[model samples]
Target: MSHGPFQAQPTTKAALENVAGQLRQVLGLEKVDFFPVVKVLEFGLPSIFENFVFRVKEGPAMGDQHGLTFPDDSEIWLRDDVYEGVTQGKGRDRFTAAHEIGHLLLHSQRFLSRRMGDQPIRTNCDPEWQANCFGGCLLMPAILVKTCKYIDEVMDRFGVSRDAARHRTKQLNLSMQEVF
Candidate 1:
């Protein structure tokens, strides 16, 4: 969405979506109406994913970034502001956390392949796109969004921003009216 994928990845949106669904199932969030993203960032990552989550102070370290994942160190750094917002159930900040989680999962040493600058940028190979797609899928799962009749319902039930909910609903086209 904004930047990233310094390297090319071997995956597609459908693959990332499947990964998100499977991750939800693994985390026992498949049936959860509102996935507790903050809890997952704080506790679940260390226990389940074994990646350390840190709420870092705003400074040169993480300038303009809500969150950053360092797969090499098995660590995730979230800006203090974003972390605070997440505690208050802010949807955009929660999406940032999910996006970092996506990086940790999909761009690890096991999957990273540095790409030359001369190569053309492709959607499926873009790490940023993958993380965004993953975040959307994880936060607003199609099955969950399909159960919603209105955009407000999606935003409220999924604890997502209006824009994110709208994008998910539009992506699914659940054949239901999307009243804003």
Candidate 2:
């Protein structure tokens, strides 16, 4: 279960933006069109999810487990509630889905390259943190966030939760006093 050194580097804002920008180009997305995240995940990156299985099965309680990706075949299993929430346009669900996608993009290579055994492999870097950072940057790009007049606008435009929008604004150190 030792993980390989695939980008086994610390997560940086620059790296996250680079990946998000690449994804935006691949999905033909504009900076203002963050609402179409689910569509991009379903259509733009079909190859990643198409070749493998994606099951929405019952699992841990909400907030406990959002999604799981099988390294052996790149299969993704999401909790039924979370899946329903995502389809229903819940902000938390959208973030969770993007978070799982982050793992796929950021950590799948290492998972695929390494051999799995009973013991779990520990790495110096935290993949979960990296994926979370990716998800945030993907959903709320710094360029777009900087243009937002208020945090509410970011939430409304991006379909992200209030907390997420606020956190992103704080992360980018964007002033919320002016309105555009």
Q: Write the per-residue lDDT of candidate 2 for residues 112-158, one digit (tens) a residue.
A: 34334544434335566667777888888888888888877887778
Question: TM-score of the candidate numbered 2?
Answer: 0.77
Q: How high is each candidate's TM-score? A: 0.89, 0.77
Model 2: CA > 4 A from native: 1-8, 48-50, 60-63, 109-124, 177-180
Query: Could you give me the TM-score of model 1 versus the true structure?
Result: 0.89
Q: Which ten residues in a row have the lowest lDDT in candidate 1?
A: 1-10
lDDT (0 to 1) per candidate:
0.79, 0.69
Worst 10 residues of 2 by lDDT: 1-10
Question: Residue 142, candidate 1: how far off, in angstroms?
Answer: 1.2
Which residue pairs show backbone clashes in model 1? none
**Deviation (Å) of 150 in candidate 2:** 1.1
Cα lDDT of model 1 overall? 0.79
